[model samples]
Target: MITLTGRLICADAAQAALVQLYLPDHIRLTRAEPGCLSFDVVPTSDPLVWQVNETFTDRAAFDAHQTRTRESRWFKETAHIRREFRIIG
Candidate 1:
């Protein structure tokens, strides 16, 4: 299994709004994907930050997630927003 942690920082109000609007679709797609063991989005106490946790069955699943997320319009729309991600075993 693999775990992914994502931290998103939205500095602009418009960017934040776009992130909020895109979140539901992101969650839905992640959860529905095959080999997805778990997916969660946690709002930080600071409104500008968001924490995402995801687990997948294996490397192939993780790669699939990458493909899907990269293809998503929401991801493209939010590309300008500051974000960081980490992967752990």
Candidate 2:
């Protein structure tokens, strides 16, 4: 299994708005993917920061998720946001 834990840092309301705008679809699509064990993104106390947690059946699953995200509107809109993450497999 592979698990990813992260925080997406949004600099301002604009970035946070982008996240809110796209995150629902992103989460829904990711959770529907084959091999996805669990996926979630939730706002932190800071409001502008979001916590992300994802688990997959294996590295291949994780890689596929990455590929999909890179092609998604969520990634295109929030690409500039800073991410702090750790991966365990």
Candidate 3:
């Protein structure tokens, strides 16, 4: 199994709301992908901070997720946001 944890912090309130507005589509598409064990995005105490927790069946699954995400509109829109992540097993 593969686990990915991260935090995405928007540049400002407008950007944060933009991310929140598109999260539902992002979650739905990601959850529908094969080998997706779990994908979660949670709001932190800071309004601009979004916590990410994702799990996949294996490295291939994780790679596929990364590829798909990189091709998504949500990913492109959030490109300027600060993101930090770590992979674990």
Candidate 4:
């Protein structure tokens, strides 16, 4: 299995708003992907930070997810936001 853990850090309220606006679609699409065992993005105690947790069947699945994300509206819209993440297998 492969897992990703992270936080999406928004610079300000405006950036955070973009997250709120796009996250549902992002979540839906990701969850619908094959080999996606689990996917979650949720707010932290700090409103500007969102915790991310994802699990996939293997490296191939994880890599595919990454590739798809780079081409997605979520990536384009939130490109300026900060991300602190790690991938584990």
Candidate 5:
């Protein structure tokens, strides 16, 4: 299994609006994918930061997620967003 943990940071007040607008779609699409074990978006104490916690069955599943996000218009539009990820043991 592979876990993808990350925090997404948006500029100023745009975080909440972006989360409300785009997170649901990301959740629905990612969770529905074949190898997705879980996909969740959580709020952070800082208004401009949000966390993304995702698990996939394997590396292939992770790759698929990368492809989907890269091709997504929503992600492209939010290109200014900053993110960081860590691998879990």
Candidate 6:
């Protein structure tokens, strides 16, 4: 299995709001993906910062998820996010 953890910080409220706006679709689509063991994207007290936690059945699944995500509108929209993330077994 692979677990992905991260913090996503937007530039400001407007950017964060953009994330908030599309969050439902993002979460729903991601969770519905194949081999998605778990997926959560939640807001923090600091509105600009959002927490991310995801798990996949394997590296291949995770890689597939990455590819799909890159092609998503959320990816194009949040291209300016400051991300701090890591993957673990």
The candidate that achieves the highest lDDT relative to the unseen native structure: 4
State the lDDT of candidate 3 residue by residue for 23-71, as single tens digits: 8999999999999999999999999999999999999999998999999
State which candidate, 1 or 5, has the greater TM-score: 1
Looking at model 5, residue 74 earns an lDDT score of: 62
lDDT of 1 by residue, 2-34 (tens): 998999999967888998999999999999999
lDDT of each: 0.91, 0.96, 0.92, 0.97, 0.82, 0.91
**TM, every model:** 0.93, 0.98, 0.95, 0.98, 0.88, 0.95
Candidate 4 residues lying further than 4 Å off, grouped into runs, are none
Supply the TM-score for candidate 5. 0.88
So what's the TM-score on candidate 3? 0.95
> Backbone clashes per model, in order?
0, 0, 0, 0, 0, 0
Task: Report the CA-based lDDT of candidate 2 relative to the real structure.
Answer: 0.96
Q: By the lDDT metric, which is better: model 5 or model 6?
A: 6
- Deviating ranges (above 4 Å) for candidate 6: none
Cα deviation of 84, candidate 4, in Å: 0.2
